[model samples]
Target chain A: MNSTIALFLLQDGVINGAIYALLGVTLVLIFAVTRVIFVPQGEFAAWGALTLASLESGATPGTALLLVVLGVSAAVVETIRERASMRPARLGVMAVRDVAMPIALLLIVSTIAPTKPALWLSVLLTLALVVPLGPLVYRLAFQPIADATVLTLFIAAIGVHFAMIGLGLIFFGAEGFRNEPFIAGVFPLGPLMFKGQSLVILAATAALLAALWFFFEHSMLGKALRATAINRLGARLVGIPTRATGRIAFALAAAIGALSGTLIGSLTTISYDSGFIISLKGFVAAIAAGLASYPVTVVAAIGVGVLESFAAFFASAYKEVIVFSLIIPLLIWRSLVTAHHDEEEE
Target chain B: MRQSIRIALLSGGVCLVGTTTLAQVNVGITVSQTGPAAALGIPQKNSVAQLPKEIAGQKVDYVVLDDATDPTKAVANARKMIAENKIDYLIGSSATPATMALVDVAAETKTPYCAMVPSKAVVDPVDEKRKWTFKAPQNDAIMAESLAEHMAANGVKSVAFLGFTDGYGQGWLEEVEKAMPAKGIKITAVERFQRTDTSVTGQVLKILASSPDAVLIAASGTVAVMPQKTIKEQGYNKPIYQTHGVGTMDFVRVGGKDVDGTVFPAGPVVVADLLPDSHPSKKVGLEYIKAYEANNKTPFAVFGAHLADCMSIAANSVKPALEKGKPGTAEFRSGLRDAIETTKELPATHGVYNYSPTDHAGLDNRSRVLIKIVNGKWTLLP
Candidate 1:
């Protein structure tokens, strides 16, 4: 390929890689904090994109209803599990956060959705609808099995993935959706045209990375999350509240996933099941980082994107095979480099 | 006591005859109701509710099952339906792999099978196993020929190909490879992408770099929009041609302005409203579309029409098949197969079927029409 074509491919790869990097970082974060593989992380992205599409089309997204349903279930599960320690104030907080909040959000969305609110409002509403779902999912699925083996948590995460996919189908139907890009122009740079949305995605990724760095390096809650990721029992001993930190990590992952979905929704057509494959690429990047280093995950995700783009160009039929096969060599190198550790006795 | 025993035997014999004449015809259906192919399967499942409840004065009981786009589950569903439901006819698994998986079971059970997918491999050559199988959708070869002819007539010399890596894509590619070469149209570039791929930019860039006169995308459903949109965004203004796999409105809806001028070969039913009254499929197509739209309260997808055509073909074959034997008998199954083979000029939504022992796809050039998306609407191309 010529320089111009190569440049175009690089630009395309970087844009996609940005999204994958965001997802990869979130996957790493969630896995580190919760000891769950978080397979349903992609589902939130799909839900975000679809919810935005529905709002644009002047219909209250079915995800609002789903949020209420999940919230109620999470509330019920949490209450029963903590019934012994539950106080009047805690019950009141649970009732408001889990039950009343979702109901109010549903009401607001249904009322404002028909008017086809502005893009920013729609996006904010989409996030509001999807972000809480992460914590709710943790409460309902993972928290119950918090002390279970990683294998069990991974299976539970897959179960949640299927459930979310099913719910996505019910909410979005089978039709795929694409949202209008936030910015609608192209910039020509040295014989290569960059789409406005691609730039937006790159900028957003950088900004999010900076925000995450600041959060972890400076913020108290972020330090607590880092501590939890380092040692759950130690963090609990230091009064960090491992459960709360886990929930916070999920919320952060959910937010990142939702934002990534919004960015991706403008770039391509997204269906209910689209997130799985996209997130799968991110998973590859995470695995390449040995599922630990965020900076390495970002770099690896970009590398994966570039590799995928080139692979598609060189061998279109084997694009997915080529991309997925990277994991094999990565695993080999990882095993060769890293020392294996036995599972810590619970 | 002897007279009473004689009377009881006589009544028993009459009751057996009564049940035999009024036996129900069980038709089992399996479709991908909740998986990747759900977009196609849901419509087919909906159309099942619109199928004829009674054919030739015999009650037709349809046992619908969800394969979830899994071929293994499709086989299991087929086996269960045959063993427990005692299905006389089987209509399957909305996708190619799942549909293909049911062929052996249909052959082994000596039952007639109807496949909703367009892959010619499902019924071509009509082997011992395939002879029992019939497909509803027009073969890829037929549509490919039409597409090649259109490209040639429009003075397109070279084309680029982009499609799914699945059977649908491979099937269309094989047909296009054959049809294009025969029309003296060269395929300059060939690319493949997965149905769930989020981006096809690299593939599109490569296709554009080849700079052919046209690009032909062989993907189906909403996924088809990705390559077209990516190509368009890259500023490739050449004519983009799609296959009948994208006949549904969802393709147009998802592709939007990028797909506006896209030329594709689709079933006549997709543009039934635009077809002249003289067209054989026009009346039936309109009728089916009306019934489906009224029931579903949405625009009728062309995929559903395939199942409707299958139902009509089966319904048309029932009368002659019933003349041979009872509904649940093997004689009836073979009779139905033979009758389906002899089907002639039977108009359905997609086309007029004329099946024969040598040809199980049962469609012709008349089954396909050239369509263009104009202003986000499907317009029949003259």
Candidate 2:
């Protein structure tokens, strides 16, 4: 209740909120492009953290095998679907992107990981291993039924979440891992001493946010993605490949998730099953933002984190209930205040 | 010549069947081998593997089942072991809930059950129903008294309590509450957290603000690491105490440098080498340590030693039954149950257990030893 204690709690809340913000943004992005709620976003973070742990221990992470399996299967499905009409050059290019690239990356990672590379290099390798599975999952599970109703896509996303959890258990085992901090030291700020990892988390979140802004604002591919997000059918009519846009959106979400995972894993001991709660918290923040507006989602995530901190201080035992219950009021207010509309006419 | 050879073969087969029925004893075990408690349960399984195969003159056959840390599965496993396997003795279940649930099966089936968890609820206030049950580990009540005595001896006047939100936490809180107030030590604050929680910053902040003389974290396993690391990172420097739940190497490895100076109570297996040569549990504890370390890839954990202690108790009782009657008979099992309840001064790895008809848990203050993490190794407190 004192000023010093309040300041410490505030700092703690902000660091946690920053991670939630990245997840919030990813949830909104996937929902916008694919009309899927993206329930398995937290699995990417678990995979990323566990993969780094395995790499540090000089063991070949099972995530590498998972990436190859998902990539090859996605490629096979795509090849079978396009076999009759696609020319040889296009098929070769597709094969290179979908199957060969993952295999090559797997070989490189398998060789480098055993040498126990620098922390930064290991993190990059982990991201590279985990990020591609996003698009591959989309292609295998969602792309074939791209025009399905939102409810159907939501159910599929849940199934994907469960499958990822099972795969995570196989890869990481039941044991939890706490990775070494990316930045190790304590910074003294007046009366409050900040952990180096906390500062790293805040800075990384800000940098990623800025990078996302630039990508969406300046690049042609960014604008095409935005166009697809706005109106998939219209964007397709205007020569934008919506399926490609969906793939790009999923890929970006995966990268964001893995980065957050690497940051959060250093701060806490994470198990194979820890992602579901974190994913639920991110979902809460996204719901607060009505699954739109990146800035609003970030702000709402910070609010969610701060509220949880205060609630833990007050009730302690009921902190989860306190944080989760906030959603009811936010939903009520959004429904009553904002204009509700159905999806745009087909 | 062919008819004479067939008659001899038939006579040899009959003698073989009779010898098998009299020589083999079945000991059934159920532990949480594949769930959140797997880290603890797997060690129990390892210890069972290291148990002396031939106790006394009878060959022991252990039937191991995985409860997956669920109470329902634990009960079902107990039923199967009692009914289908017709086990003469049972040892189980690393977690408290599962152990407590299995107690009913033990009572109903009239089979001697040895529980591995620390909660006194497994055996305290003994009655007719609990006559068939016994526990090997030092109970929370006994350990709490040792911790409280340690605090009082050090001139500590106030303490803060932090524990898991489930049965383990509640049990520690109750015992600490009973022990501390009796010694004129005031509890300044109490806090609880879930095992799966990723952060305890808010709880840590409040504990720091209260500024008690010491903090006692009552959580078990790797989950206790969160609060310990957070309190250290937040710069709360005072005596920190943990329950025996944090005695494993995984807890130390996860907490790392943060656990360097923390003090706690643990079974003698944790500090067997550091104890005085005359300590009662030292020799048996050292024997268990060697046997466990030889078989397990990880460092010797107290859970395995605790399970070993339970198996020792079961074996001791089975020896008497084997001498009195044949194996796999109802009379032998009933006699085993009666013999276990009368165990006296039986030295094991954790402690010398003395079981009676009225009290089943058999362990006392002697089972607990005060241990501190000095320079990352468990050092025995003088």
Candidate 3:
């Protein structure tokens, strides 16, 4: 409650808020484009974290070079998948090829230069579905329910939750592993103490945000994607590959989620159940922002994270009480505000 | 040969019917096994369940009930274990709430209860610790004192405390707080959290803002892990301290690498990583790990392994009474207490146990040591 307490909480809030923003952005992107929530995004983070220690010591520095080569192979694989999908008679082949690309890319690239081979290998097995399975989800699950209520999309998301939990257990195993501190140095400036890891997280988050802003402001693809986000029918009518834009956004968000997961894992210990906790936090952030607005969701995610950290700090005898208390009130408040806004719009 | 042995046992039993048939006593134990706190409660349950099996020659029936970390359910189950099951002796009463509930029943029925609750109230029960009541491990005061001593030894001058605002955390934190000033350690910031909290950021940031030399989180089990994670994530790079409650197996799994450099005040068994090869305690720990893993088909928790050893001593106390003649409940209780005290060198899996009536737990001040998590493994720093 004092300045000392408030200052650190704010700093913590900013870090937490930024991470939440990244996650919320990912969730919103997939929900809008694919009509699937990609409930397994948090698990991808957990897997990335579990593999960080190995990556620190063992991954080949040549992976960046290898990725360039693999990108061409991946582009070719996608062309083949597109061809198969066009043939109504061989629809199953397209499905198979679509599901094979992400896994294939991870395996082929990782095998050649994996630093922490075992950990990265395990993570790849858990998360390779990030790309290839999106279309299959669209064709098999979402296509049937595309015309259903918004409530139905939410329900399918809940089902995604169960499947992701099972996938985490099946791939990464249920045991928790320790995440070594990514930062090793600390310096104090009078009243303020700083951890190198915290600095890295903050700095990296800032850089990512700046880069994203530039991409959206100056780049052709980013502008086209934004246009696609605004009006899908108009974008398609104007010769924009709206579907392709959606695919790129989905892939980028997933890769960002992968980055977040690796950073989290690098920073803490993790287990298969890490995603359940993530889902709870991310969903709250999404809802608090009305699940539509960009800046609001980011701000809400970080604010909630800081509040959550404080809740965890305070009543640890029942640490969960703090979390529920903080989020439930915000949710109720948001509902009231949203209702009032809807009445005004009407 | 088997038919002949059965006929021999029938004849011997008939001859000793007046003596043996009146004795086969039953002891009841109730603890959690499957809930959130089951991480700690399960070990106690396993230790209690294994008692009869370990002491094979004794004709004792052990009745164990799983409360699964629910206090109301635990109290209900305790009542069933007593009133319905009609156990002759009661050995467990694991958590503070559960043990407190059972104390009322034990006092009413005048049942001798060997306490497993890790609170000061267990020693000085509300109506005063009955002559029938005995404890097998260190109480809150000892853990507090040991923790202070451990912190002092490492040159930790200032500390921040984050504890649950409940009986267990409050009770132990008070004892540790009172002892800290004398040890030259200052408490800079104090924060309270419910045991079920999911984020400890506010309190952790508060502590981080204080920038104290160290932090001690006096909460138990899984509840202790989250704040530890968030604190480090925000990059609070000070030594985090924990009392007896947080320094066990489950917290390690929860906190992961965030717990590295976090220190816990614990029994000698926890800091076994520091024991020299020549140390007898080291040998005991090694043997216990081997024997326990072999018997249970799972890795052993330090607390659970210690609990099993304590029970072995308790059961050994009644061996002579069982052999000389079948002894009743009171006789076994007193004999067990005496048996625990009489062992000059326990040759236990932990260390040589030495106890007296005044020291019911059989652990000395030397029993507590400072253990730190470095990277992913437990090690003794000093």
Candidate 4:
């Protein structure tokens, strides 16, 4: 291929890689803290993008109703599980945060969505609608089984993934939606032109990465989360509130997923079932890093994106096969390189 | 009081006697209602509400099931319907693979089957298995011929090909290969992508590198927008041709301005209002569109028209078949098959059908019309 075409493909790869990197990082964080593979991470992104599209079209997004339903279910599940230790103040807090907050958000969105609010307001509302779904899902599906084996948690994540996909279909309908770009236009860079939205995605990814680094290196909660990721029992023994840390990890993952959805939604169509493939790509990146190192996951995600683009250029029919197959070699390498350890002994 | 009780008893007895003699015709329908093909199947399911409750003086019973786009489930559904429901007619499984799965069951049960998919393999060569099968959509070859003719007329010499990797894409690719070559057009590039692919920039780049005079996208539904949009974004502004699979309003809605100039061959029903009064399908197409929109409380999707046409063909055959035997009897099913095969000059939503023993698809060149998307609306091309 000519250099110009190669550069164009590179630009496309990097843009896609930015979104995949965000998802990969989230996958690592969630896996580390919760021991869950987070299969439903892409659903959150799909919900975010579809929700934004709904708002932009002056319709009340179904996610608002979903939030309320999930919130009520989470509150009920948490209350029944913690009944023995529940206090009156804790009950009040649960009632307000779990039940009241979603209803309030629903009311506000219902009021402004039909008015076709500004793009920024619609995006803010989308985040408000989708981000809480993460912790709510955690509270309802994973909290009771927090100490379960990784396989059990992974199975539960898959169940949640299917449930969310079904719910996504009901909420968004079967038609695919593409949102207007947050930014429009293109910038000429030597032989190649960069789309404005692609630049936005790159800038956003870098900013999010820097912010995450700051949070982990400087913030107390981040250190607590890191401690929990290192040793859940040890963190709990040191009064770290492991359940809270799990919720925090989920919330961050959801935020990242939602942001990625908004970024990529403009680049391609977003359907109810579109999230699985996107997140699967991210999973490939996480696996490439052995699900441990954040920097490695990000860098590997970009590499995966570049490889996928070139594969598509060369063999479009086998693009997916090639992309997913990379994980096999990476897995073999990881197995040979890393020393084996028994988790039960730990 | 005694007289009134006697009169009620007499009427109840008459009703019971009448119910025993009333003919009942059962039809089984299976479509992908909740999976990847739901966009196509949901409309077909919705069109079921428009089907006649009674046909040819018989009570028509419809048993609709969702296959979820799984071929295994489609087979199971077909077997269950045949065994339990004792349906004489079968229509279903909106996609090709699932629809093809039902063919064996249809042949084994000797049921008259109507498929909504466009693949010619569903019924061709009049094999023993396919004798019981028929389809509503225009065959891919017919539509491909229309597209190739349009390209040739416009002075296009070479074209790039992009389509799905599934049966639909491969089927179209084969047709395009045959049609384009006959029209003396060269295919410069061939690329395939999944329906769920998030990007086609790489494929678009490859197509651009080859730099054909035109592009033909053989995908259906909302996914068809991706390659066109990518190609446009790359500043390649040559003519682009799409297949009939993208005749849905959702395609126009999703593609928006990017698909403004897209030209494709579609069922005449899509542009029913614009079709001339002399057109054979205009009246029937408009009526179906009106009824569908009113019943579904949404704009009529072109996919739904396929099912409506199937129902029309079934309705026409049922009248003559009743002369042979009872509705549930094997004699009646064989008679129905013969009647469908003998169907002549029957106009439905999509087009007029003239099915024969050798041709179960029944649609001709009149079924297809070249349509261009202009300002988010379908305009009939002269």
Per-residue CA lDDT of candidate 1, range A172-195, in tens?
899899998999988988899988
Superposition error at B3 for model 3 (Å): 37
Cα RMSD to the true fold for all candidates: 5.8, 6.4, 10.2, 5.3
For the second chain, the TM-scores of the candidates in order are 0.93, 0.92, 0.80, 0.93
What lDDT tens digits, residue by residue, belong to model 1 across residues B13-87?
543454456798888889998988899888888888778989989888877788889999999989877766667
lDDT of 4 by residue, B44-124 (tens): 899888889988788887777788899999998888777666678999988888988888889988999999988898999
lDDT of 3: 0.60
Cα error, candidate 1, residue B224 (Å): 1.7
Between the candidate structures 1 and 3, which one is better when assessed by DockQ?
A: 1
Fraction of native Cα contacts kept in each candidate? 0.71, 0.47, 0.35, 0.65
Which pairs of residues have clashing backbones in candidate 2?
Answer: none
Name the top DockQ candidate. Answer: 1
Which parts of model 4 have CA positions greater than 4 angstroms off? A82-85, A344-346, B1-22
Which ranges of candidate 2 are over 4 A from the true structure? A56-62, A65-107, A136-163, A217-247, A334-346, B1-23, B323-330
Q: Give a tens-digit lDDT track for model 2, residues A1-346.
A: 8898788778888888888899988998888888889999998888888888888877778888888888778777888897798788977886898779888988998899889989989998988888898888899899988888888899999999878876787677666778889889898999998888999999999999999999989999889988888888899999999999889998998899888888988788777777777777888899888887888899999888888888778878888888899999999998998898777335
The lDDT for every candidate, in the order shown, is: 0.89, 0.84, 0.60, 0.90
DockQ of each: 0.65, 0.44, 0.18, 0.64
